[model samples]
Target chain A: MNDYRITTYEPRHRGAVVEFQQMLWQGGAAGNSAYLDWKFGANPYLDDRYVTLAWQESELVGMLGVFGSCWEVDGHGRVMLPCLADTVVAPAHRGGPLFGRMLEWLVERLRADEVPWLLDFGDQPAGPAMLMSGWTAVGPWPVAVAEREVLGSGEGEWSAREAVRGSRSGATITPVATSLPEMPALAAETRSRGSVRVVRDEEYFRWRSRNPLARYFHLVAEEQGTVGYLIAHRTAVDTDDGPTPTTIVECEALDDDVWRDLVEAAVATLPGKVVTMWVRDLAPAREQSLASLGLSPTRPSGRLSQDIHLPKLVMRSTGVVDDAGPLATLTSPDVWDMRGVSGRGWR
Target chain B: MSGSHDVQDVARTVLDCLRNKLFLDGVTADTHLIESGLIDSVGFIRMFVVLEEEFGIEVTARDLSLERFQNVGSISRFVIEKLAEGGGSDKPAEAVRA
Candidate 1:
């Protein structure tokens, strides 16, 4: 094992951290630096920046970050917990115990602070390792995709244009200039099912809209007040076919018909070739709405097969709380309201 | 119901996958795959796919433990146990030998 020094992130280490994330961010240091600041600096949940770094002498070799997130557990109170994100190791230092060591150090620190639980919205590539490290895998949450080609219209451009203008449901879908002030009310009114969900207040909406990594579009359905709303963001993803423009619906109205109309309006106006969102099983109405919009879920061969590349909610107890009361609720997939909880939809 | 021959076949298939898919050579049944960082997350998933296809076994969330995949020996033992539990095909191990 190499003798690598592990330490917490300090402001002086900002420049190196930004440079280290360039490969991961792909938008150069400037964009990554801004993103880092917005995520950790302006965050309302936690005060200190919780980033762990591994250094081989003076060179930064690996990094793991934890950002504060607020979750509202039904019947239970709200708690601010850390969500693991931005895990990266330099290419030259790949295949080593550096990542494990860094993770160990971070977990230890969180444990010392008496954090009850830790959450991770990691990709499939990191899934097995997280599972091995005692993190409970929640849902592999199937994602629904809407593609222009799948509509089977020879006049692809015309169909999408028509989708934007065709609102037969009598709901007026208008693109909002900024994050809706009534987002919290709208969310509260729509959410009837009891589960743990991110507290999507005005503060969260404001912070989420300020993501420097992607461009966001907010559309609201106003009958009297804000009846329903949809938040979608577009970002470039390097697929096998090269960098393709991908739009992800981060959050939407829970009402089926409203959701369908919001999605239809957004898809027609969004510039991306593909638009996707996480689909939970219990919401048959939401599923029907997506189907109505010509979106279909990508079928993996098996749940545990290698074809399973979707992100899952992984969690672990910090061991600070002896009671397994909260952990039981968290581990159950059915108890999670996972919309916009993924923190930056493209994770 | 699995015998020594079945275990050997499973081990061989695992070794072949380690070499072919992960580009990991010189691995023994007792060699450390996870702790030594010989196989990464991507490599682990690739090996997973191969084991599922070769053995016609379903690896579930409960099976995703470090102890089950720590090394070739452990993996072979797990596959054999799963096969005995009717988790995989009843076909002879020779048919799926990598």
Candidate 2:
């Protein structure tokens, strides 16, 4: 029964990959051919060589997808980093050695190709897997949830959006369908702050935030010039409580006042839906701003901890370990920051 | 390393890290790390890193299920399988070696 084989992804395996993913997701992600193509195919950072598949004879049993990212690593300037995306092992194979085998193969490839670092916002049980696979766990990444009502039920009489707009602050919040033209410059300015962050340039915004299949919303608030923008997605998840719609705030760059206005707009538009975002829990100023929006800090005991319903930020280095200067800085939680709506981004 | 040898090695490494950092005096193979409140969220992550580096095993997220990781014996079995067969397929580690 040694029918195990692994290889790089080929176009011929598209349908099979979709079927495999659909089975793994249990139809929640609509892992059809089109979605897979757009996700893996349209990736600006996609290296055809990096998309990997594991097969048991004729069956596509497992997959590890890697998306290319431009990241600002401390002391290294801007570098190309690969983010490990969707990883799925079929139901029958869930608790076996297959996951580690696939990952070992993936890591071997990364080491051979000289990929610098691997970045991912993995939801369990993959998050814990990453830590076990020699990836550094960096958290408690803040998941700020703004619940209008307890248990996220009951609608409020006053709309956060209307109140925000009606205020005497004079800032205006407008929702747009695409990334704003000014976003490229603003994103560049954001990276100039010296925090380890994703390079959210114009290309990244257009590709990541403007996917055709997903209903990602871009809301911009401005008073004098472009104050800031918020990238949001709406989706639901099955929790211990129940199924609840959530407004996922993907990424944002705003001053305190404008941040307030944009969050207000999201709360208004979604009304009762809970709003969530990833913030640097260690940073006092960032935590204070999110606290103002009513998001509490949720940390899981381990990647597999039951509370993993909350999000976590985990990373690992694929770079030369001996050249410890830059990698050491990257490994430090103090220098690194995760600010976005991550983890299986509503497709 | 033989299976039993590897198991003892893993148990030693795990217990040493736990005892020094969290100050737990006695931890046996059957000790429930999570249940006894010995390894909290922070300690669990620290332990994961140490084991992966020491044993050269890849521990995936799904493998963190309580069934496989709740005790020293389970964690040792996991490391053995990974080391023996590279942790990809469910085929018995002995079969691959044979």
Error of 2 at B23 (Å): 29
Q: Write the per-residue lDDT of candidate 2 for residues B1-98, one digit (tens) a residue.
A: 33454667867766675677546668766798766655544566566555655665545454656666677778777777777776433322121110
RMSD (Å) of each candidate, 1 decimal: 5.2, 11.5
Q: What would the per-residue lDDT of candidate 1 be over residues A169-271, giving only the tens digit for each residue?
A: 5567776556778766777665545578778888887877777776666777766666677776654323313334345545456456666788787666655
lDDT of 2: 0.60
TM-score of chain A of 1: 0.88
- What is the DockQ score of candidate 2, to 2 decimals? 0.07
lDDT of 1 at A109: 88
Each candidate's interface RMSD, rounded to one decimal? 7.9, 16.2
The DockQ for candidate 1, computed on C-alphas, is: 0.33
TM-score of chain B of each: 0.76, 0.67
Per-residue alpha-carbon lDDT of model 2 for A1-347, expressed as tens digits? 33569888998987788778765443344535655666667777665568789899899888887777666776677777677767887766654567667777877788887775676666646555455557776554445666665233222222222323514235777766567877666656553333676666777767776443444556676677777676765432233134344555444554556666666666556423466666553235545655555665454433233344455556666655557456556666667555543664525
Native A-B contacts reproduced, model 1: 0.42
The candidates' DockQ values read 0.33, 0.07
